[model samples]
Target: MKRRKVPLRMCISCKEMKPKKELLRIVKNSEGKINIDLNGKLPGRGAYICHNPQCLEKAIKHKLFERIFQQKVDKEIYVRLTDILTENDEDI
Candidate 1:
């Protein structure tokens, strides 16, 4: 038997280190499209956020995506992220 290593990621909003699987990923693809990477396998530059709404709101309020992606983020992207986060919360 072998011990498995857990991948850790930092939440951009909360600045907390958590297991990768527990964080939501957002990616900026090669074509410069920003999207929520629900599968966490999207090919692009990625930023991590916690599953909590407070973290999401903090990220949006601070415009962390703009700093992460180095460009302006569309309002729809935030809306979509919020929708997805809330939807996932309901399942918990």
Candidate 2:
């Protein structure tokens, strides 16, 4: 018997391919709302980023998140994104 392969996703910030379950997924729903998808089951355009503050900063500074979503990100949302990154770091 063969083991199943794990799905891999590329991080928008670091541009590194990592296991999907290890990275966090940020998604923009049909209504153009952006939020973190903990379950990775949200239906919409999504972007991947490592759970690292440095990557979050890079992605925000370079507007990579906006590029992935094809829309300007809300300032408040970016703040929340950073906060979330910090919080995730605390968990580790």
What is the C-alpha lDDT profile of model 2 across 12-53, one tens digit per residue? 999999999878899999999998888999999888999999
Question: With candidate 1 superimposed using the best TM-score fit, by how many Å does residue 47's alpha carbon deviate from the native?
Answer: 0.2
TM-score of 1: 0.92
RMSD of each: 1.1, 1.3
Best by TM-score: 1
TM-score of 2: 0.89
Residue pairs with backbone atoms closer than 3 Å in model 1 (clashes): none
TM-score of each: 0.92, 0.89
Against the reference, the lDDT scores of all candidates come to: 0.94, 0.90
Clash totals for all models, in order? 0, 0
Residue-wise lDDT of candidate 1 within 4-67, one digit each (tens)?
Answer: 9999999999899999999999999999999889999999999999998889999999999999
lDDT minimum window of 10 residues, candidate 1: 83-92
RMSD of 1: 1.1
